[model samples]
Target: MSVLPLVFTSGWASGINAYAVVLLLGVFGATGLTDEVPASLQRTDVLIVAAVLFLCEAVADKIPYVDTVWDTAHTVIRPVAGGVVGALLAGQSGSLSDITAGVVGGSTALASHFVKAGTRMAVNTSPEPFSNIVLSTAEDLGVAGIVTFAVFHPTAAAIIAAVLLATGLAVLVFLWSRIRRFLRRRAQRREEKRLADGGRIPGRAGPPPW
Candidate 1:
């Protein structure tokens, strides 16, 4: 029972939604639903704090600009949480050094975090808010499902996480240029719209009436 699979899976999930992973693991550990989970993670204080943060994230993550801001703020927090959780998982097995697990978790989380943040930024270029809400909800669900599965089937979950991470990165790379162009076009459109509406563009005077 190498904890590597759980470490990777949890790290990936944490990048997307660390609080949810914490809340789910804590709840499962507290209820004796999962023996692999660490006791400290099951503490009442940990659960409460995770729940509160999760709630806040749930709301903030559905707002376009706000979600980006929230993501920026959490650029460090999520990876650290991933490392901590990974270490805790390793501690349960006592077969691996906590430092090793922490490195794996932190590195995996950082990769996934960049993917998530970049995708969210691209999605935010759209003016509609529903896409943000939908994407956020999907991420929350994905984290919950993967973490739950990881508890009982770590190897399978790890495989799945790896596939997903690779696929997402590939897609992002393939579309990177297109995404940048699209965002630029959207910005230009917005600027034009504002000028047409007699709003001044930064560094430019108001447009003359047609």
Candidate 2:
């Protein structure tokens, strides 16, 4: 059977999000977007992942073009999450089950991550460094929580993950809007400065115009 439903329903991931982190990267261990998940809202492990990803995204924004750069680098890291999840599931089953779970989980995570990353790149310009960072930190916290709760409260893990993921996404959208406004204002100021400097005129008697 699929540990995914187990993981997803068992406080691992939500539906679409389940496909991203738990199914692709965490399950398959691949390193491509075709193997990741969408950036959509999630309720389980996917939510936790969203939080982590949001942080990664924030870091990427801080570095100018590093958002894309982070996306590229994460190809490797994405699958690793899948592997970890698979290993966890396999422990509950037999040896063969573990290996299978690893592959499937990694694959799912990859697909989900790819979709999420692609969407973010397509929509935004530059990056909102601080907001993304906060988003990512939230994700890290969610992941840690899931791991801790998997033993005692599997279902709660899913609920917690969903809550964390949704919160991150909402925060991201909010930050995105604010950042855009800030950038536009900054651009306007720069342009005005340029125009003012260029328009400076000197008296004919003067030798040089500053």
Candidate 3:
């Protein structure tokens, strides 16, 4: 969907160009600092795209004001774009089709933006001005690339666009597992300490005092 639109607006050539930039940054930008996604996906092109998007987000997010600002700007742009594209492409598909397209597109775009925004909060450990500006500029270029290429060369662009969508899902799954483990450990410790201190339930004690 994203690649299709990007190709539509940018010219097919622009779409491919956009896809390449995202792939380069996403696949090789960083390793574990963000998420540990493979450079390429198995079957889905979106996985590769998500990897790049995630990587681009990871890099942009590390900056203080940069990531926040970029997300804010895109919130309005990404969704409307999604809606417009959906409406146009779903010709004769009726209102439901447009609505469905809008919903899916908007959701995907918002999630991608959210991950990018959230990462910056943790990455602001380095207060370097140059790095911040560089990252922000790169992201700006990424958006432009997608927008430009959406019209000219959709097939190539579509393949590139698919990479990021899948990567985001992988990143979320990885984060969720880590969080679940942490919570479980924390709960077990609390339970152990409570039992050691005889903090058992007054009425539900073992054997019921029989």
Off by over 4 Å in 1: 178-210
TM-score per model over all chains: 0.85, 0.43, 0.43
lDDT of each: 0.90, 0.47, 0.46
Task: Kindly list the per-residue Cα lDDT of model 3 for residues 29-112, writing each as its tens digit.
Answer: 233322211233222574466456656655655466565555565566555544444443343224335565555455555555
lDDT score of model 3? 0.46
Per-residue CA lDDT of model 1 for 1-210, tens digit only, reads: 699999999999988999999999999999999887899999999999999999999999999879877988999999999999999989998867899999999889988988888788788877899999999999999999999999899999999999999988887787687568656876898889877778654667656545
Instruction: Return the top candidate by TM-score.
Output: 1
Error of 2 at 158 (Å): 4.0
Arranged by TM-score with the best first, the candidates are: 1, 3, 2
lDDT of 2: 0.47
How much is the lDDT of residue 189 in candidate 3?
82
Q: Which candidate is the best by lDDT?
A: 1
**TM-score of predicted model 2?**
0.43
> Residue 200 deviation, candidate 3, in Å?
42
Clashes of 1: 0
Q: Which order, best to worst by lDDT?
A: 1, 2, 3
Candidate 3 residues lying further than 4 Å off, grouped into runs, are 1-63, 66-81, 88-96, 168-210
